[model samples]
Target: MIRIAQLSCGAEYSGIQRELERAAEIVGAKMISPEVSLEDVMDVEKRFGVSVPSGDLNLIMARATRLVENPDLADAVFVATCFRCAEGAIIRGEVRRYIHEHSRLPVLSYSFTERTTAETLLTRMEALVTTARMRGLLARERQTGLTAGIDSGSTTTKAVIMRDNQIIGRGWVPTTEVIKSAEEAFQQALQESGVKREEIQGIGVTGYGRFLVGKHFDAKLIQEEITVNSKGAVFLANAQKGPATVIDIGGMDNKAISVQDGVPGSFTMGGICAGASGRFLELTARRLGVNITDLGKLALRGSYKSVPMNSYCIVFGTQSLVNSLSKGARPEDVAMAACHSVAEQVFEQQLQEVEVKQPVIMVGGTSLIEGLPKAMEDLLGIEIIVPNHAQYIGAVGAALLVSGMLEV
Candidate 1:
């Protein structure tokens, strides 16, 4: 169904706008405009403090089937593209609330550090549907009870409730202080699942911030991300697949791993770089006048020469992009350049200690960017395979792990 997309990445707003053209290509997809609904326009005043323009909000609020039947013509829209530049996940939290209150369609939100692609973007959307379907089966009947897993990623918090390895409910929220976000999203999934707190047999937490909340969980499993990630990946990847490298771009950090036998064996981290994580891509997308979700598809054009961006520092990059534009650099080129630098840096970091595994797994929000994986895979000379549930990996693993565990 054609729907409105409300994108609020970080600072690089101009970069995003120029990158999200693919979103406009969805068969029935309609880009938001003033003609559809009021609340979705860029800086469209909140008339009477209730609704504004652009049908993005209404579309989100409306059921998908109904949207298909009585499709809102004013489907597409562009937000400020730069609401809270450095607010981190706080802005995401607020954005989610805004999309929830305004639109009737299921909001398709994606964040980036460098750039993502269409395949990666669809993988996330697929994860949501798969999780929802898995949730349906648990409702039929069960005896072992249900469990919830909380993946406290550096940028976002995702929770899943499952019974017998099947997802019963899921929740995705930005990470605002690890423990707090975990608690909040945990409660949300429980409420959404309509399952009582006591009914939850166990809880698992993963990612960089997992430790902070591990103490609070029903039973915290402080294992490597590769372990938890593979647990989730194997479920989504084709059975014919073999050893692979997984590159997970979180909001605050980046992880690279080698997985074989459906388990993580070796891995590395690039520390935390606000200038080059999934959120940065989002900010850049917004700056370029495109949606982050549309970044990868737009970048696929790859014809123009890239505009040079000196530093990966967010603020510096923002200023540099403006100066580059003034210097007459093509927007497409500039966006791809930013993605290139990030890919180069990631490859350098991942290849520092160990050789990168072939058939790589590109997970997290950054993977969804259109051309990012292509660029990175080329640089690393390896195949990159992004799984369907990449974003929900930590949450899904934690949930499945907790489902059969005895109380600890």
Candidate 2:
């Protein structure tokens, strides 16, 4: 079994440690804590250049040091802290960064509430285990055969056809029934690519409805979005050999992943509210009496500073949009404010959990929104790459990875 070292503060006291262990076990990995002596704990601040008044946090640092010194003690690292503890959050990021920089271990950092459950941490644990166990698969630079990938997402279903590492055809439509939407998109791709279903050597499925779609399509691989999306983003951007960050703001949730050499190290997903997602922008576009695609270009023509937006709640944000319009705020200004609102929340809620690396790749359908990526670029103060086929990322990733399973 893969050993996933646990470096955490307050999980035991908060009574969520069992959930963490159970999550690891469900993913076929064991969660272990590295041993640290009292002296090691005492000298943690001296070694790491960070001091904390909490004794438990200091002990956590000591364990991090031990893991760094003895990289073989764990195959991957899980660093967690209490959601209510501001100090613990800072330490969590620092410890995660330290581990990723100092060792080859894949790191996953999370902030747990008292009600956190095994299901909540299962995907993350599984992704960490996949990154550690399947490094060779993740490192494959090219696709070798004809393949198909399907992404059944919350708001839309997408499919892509790739032959010899080249995307030949793609299909996209708003999601309705899971299987129906997947099949519709898949058929569209097949018709465009001029290939029969049986001609494809491999198939992969991902996103929210992956299991159902995978079962229906007899998919060779079914994976979560963290690893699959990261792989596709890096592959599409042609940044397979260096440190990079990927941001995908989906309709219902968001994902921020930090990767190294095409393999994911640390990632964060989900948000407290839909105000941080593309759904909020859809609502904003509706209230502004324009199509969603036009919102981004409209925002580019206006200044967000003239409008005040609520980034914490979707309902309140809609209300703010109404109020701003009542006060005669420009539609363009409201649009820009909405884009900035979602970008700021993503930065606070998800991006802070992992280290931000260069060559940031933004994927998903939302990346096509001009204002969203522009807003992200302004906030991060770096150029963000939106590669070709950004909207078909999950499908592209699924297709690329499933090709590895074909016999040479």
Candidate 3:
């Protein structure tokens, strides 16, 4: 039986421990969590050269260190922390590094806050267990047959063709009718790749309109956007050796996905309100009498720092932009301010339940807005990675899924 060492700050969360136990059962793993106390923390700090800060994180690190050192404790380690606590982030990074350097055990990390739902945590824990069981099994023979993946996103439909594990063709179209857009994108890709429909062995569909496309086109595989996006980002960034965080800014929404060992451990999505998504930028650009394509360049030209917009609703935020313009704020300043507002909304609202780690991969059509990634990087204090074909990554990921290269 696989044994997993579960470590956490032990913060008071209503029914969270029970949920963790349930997750272990679902993943077929026996959970072992050692009791941590203040004295234990101090001893670890003194004896093992591990720093113990004055907070709940101190307890978590002490317990985690013991689990890492004791080979008999478990076959894998799982760490949980509160996303809102800055100390938790520090502890998570430190403990993850220590475990990786000291032992060869698989480690998974999760962040929970007041708003974290049980369903979300369970999904991540299951993915972690699946990854652990499948580790070191990535070696596979190259696939020769043609496979295709279609991503019918809210804003655009994208398609890609893969042959011999290489992207032979890709296409995208602004979404109007879901089925029509998907058909167009797929046909374009097929034309470019010169791969006939009869030759394609498998077809996978993903994104918001996945079901619509899957039902209409008879797709062989259907998967959630978060799962496919994680697979795609990891492949595009070539970061399969380590963990990565994928920030995908789509047309109507945004998603932050934490990928541990090529599988999605956890993910967070923007609220129903379109305040923090690509639509916000498009609306704000039109209100400012600038094309959406030019908004990024205009923001970069701003000479003054703009005040952060505080409205949580996109409608109210658009009005605020107009008010700022009426108050003699420069167009460039307002554009920059809108970009900052988008980043603020993502971090404060969308990502309140997840700890964002480095080597962040930015994707989606909204990510093409040059200033948004820069704004996010400035706010997060980390460099952001934008791949060459960021917009079509979901389609690429779907194709990879069809090729049996990544686990769903």
What tens-digit string does per-residue lDDT give for candidate 1 at 43-77?
Answer: 22332133223343333223222333343532432
Best by TM-score: 2
Ranked candidates, highest lDDT first: 2, 3, 1
Model-by-model lDDT, in order?
0.56, 0.91, 0.74
Q: What 10-residue stretch in candidate 1 is worst by lDDT?
A: 134-143
Q: lDDT score, residue 50, model 2?
A: 86
Let me know the TM-score candidate 1 reaches against the reference structure.
0.57
- What TM-score, to 2 decimals, does candidate 2 have? 0.98
Per-residue lDDT of 1-408 in model 3, one digit per residue for the tens? 677787777535534776676677765776787666677787766644656565566776787767766757777777778766677766776676567557656666666665555465554454455445544332222333578989998888999999877888888898999999999999999999998878888888888788899998888766657767777777777776567889987787777876666665445565546878888889988988889889988887773266446447888888888888888888988888888888777876655444477789998887788888888888888999988788888887777766763334
lDDT of 2 by residue, 32-74 (tens): 9999998899888788898799888888899999999999899
Q: TM-scores of all models?
A: 0.57, 0.98, 0.72
User: Predictions ranked by TM-score, top down?
Assistant: 2, 3, 1
